[model samples]
Target: MNRYESMMNHLLVQFSNTKVLQAIFCAISDELQLLDDTFNNLKEKRWIDTGEGAQLDGIGEIVDRNRLINNAITINFFGFENQINTTGFNQARFREYSEPYLSSTSLSDEEYRLILWAKVNKNNSLCYMNDTIKSIQFIFKTDIAIVQDIYNAKFIVGIGRKLTKNEILFANALDLIVRPAGVSCQSMTHFDKDNVFGFYNQKFAKGFGQAPLSEIFSNNLIKKGYVV
Candidate 1:
């Protein structure tokens, strides 16, 4: 078996063996030393040799792994209530529910806007903005209607923002999926390279219309429309 499988099996044995548990408690300090040695040997040699090791590449990955491990350990070692009290830990509890929404390719213009708005707001609940409410109230707001075409169609979600150096670095590092409203090729030209416009223009023309960002946000475009 692999190191991971071995470790899991060892853990399961430790849990099931009352004699082993009693022995472990009696020799807790020595047991920890042995465990540490065993784990050290099991860890990837490359990770131990390299200074950087197998450290996660991004914060999101780190957070996600932490969530996974925390959940597993808690469920195995303690009961559900004993789960760590942390933002991402609690967030992980409902992760299955959030996964579909996070991975969703189909959403209406209003729904897309609401999702972006929720990200910007950094709130748990999806709520509509006054402007968004007004827009929905005035427009058809149908699932069939493309939001990008109906609206100003300037901003593109999931694009790197160029507002400031810190913002740029943060956006790049986080790989954020949200951008400012009304920010388009014309508006971004002053800061970004000309190629940015060309890339997005081609992307828009290929299947998406003038408002590529809006088209991407639209659930209909991704789910049923011709746009790939």
Candidate 2:
């Protein structure tokens, strides 16, 4: 029922529905409706999951104050545009690089919200190794493991399945951004069930070329993101 109808029902039995009272109730109902709408908007638009347009932009600014990031590059579903190879012509011809690539397409509100929340969660991290893993996990919504090589000052992130073109881009950029200073990171995917390349022997002295020395699959290792 509308506010006016509810107001009329609340009156005593002796009171009549006069024209003057109806006019006053109609005015009051209009004002109350506007107030109710404003409050309802606040309830729906306050969070990232339900926010849209200006509300999503406001949330982005809160986490990414510097505005160093662009939605086009991060959230674009299409591949990079205007790509130029600095090396020989073969570079990036049959292969792709995770370098700070650009995108020409626009990102939808939902896509923007997803990436924004991932960055926000990463920014709020405590810089611990587990936090780093968790941040990456939040992005892909999958289980992954990180191998830390403290001696070499590097780490290897392993995912079980293959990542799509767009996912590879996001994963590469995220790894570089969240990595610690002076440390390197690499993303590896499509691992075997055994987690090793070949079988072992009693002597453990297999020949150098006995098994596959390099990665078994293509696009298994995505290099770190390039700043330039």
Top candidate by TM-score = 2
Worst 10 residues of 1 by lDDT: 67-76
Which regions in candidate 1 have their CA more than 4 angstroms from the true location? 1-121, 124-158, 161-195, 198-217
Compared to the true structure, candidate 2 yields what TM-score? 0.61
Distance from true location, Cα of 121 in model 1, Å: 7.4
Candidate 1 lDDT by residue in tens digits, 1-228? 443334335665547556665555545545665777677755643221221223321222323311111111111111134122213443444434233211112333333333233333332323324333233222222222111312465432222222332222222222223223443311111112112233434432223342223212222321221122
lDDT (tens digit, per residue) of candidate 2 on 119-222? 77667666678776776566666675444554677666654444455565555444433556676664344332233243456122234465322122122222
Q: Which 10 consecutive positions of candidate 2 have the poorest summed lDDT? A: 216-225
Candidates in order, TM-scores: namely: 0.18, 0.61
Checking candidate 2 for backbone clashes, the offending pairs are none
What TM-score number comes out for model 1? Answer: 0.18
User: In order, what lDDT does every prediction score?
Assistant: 0.30, 0.54
Best by lDDT: 2
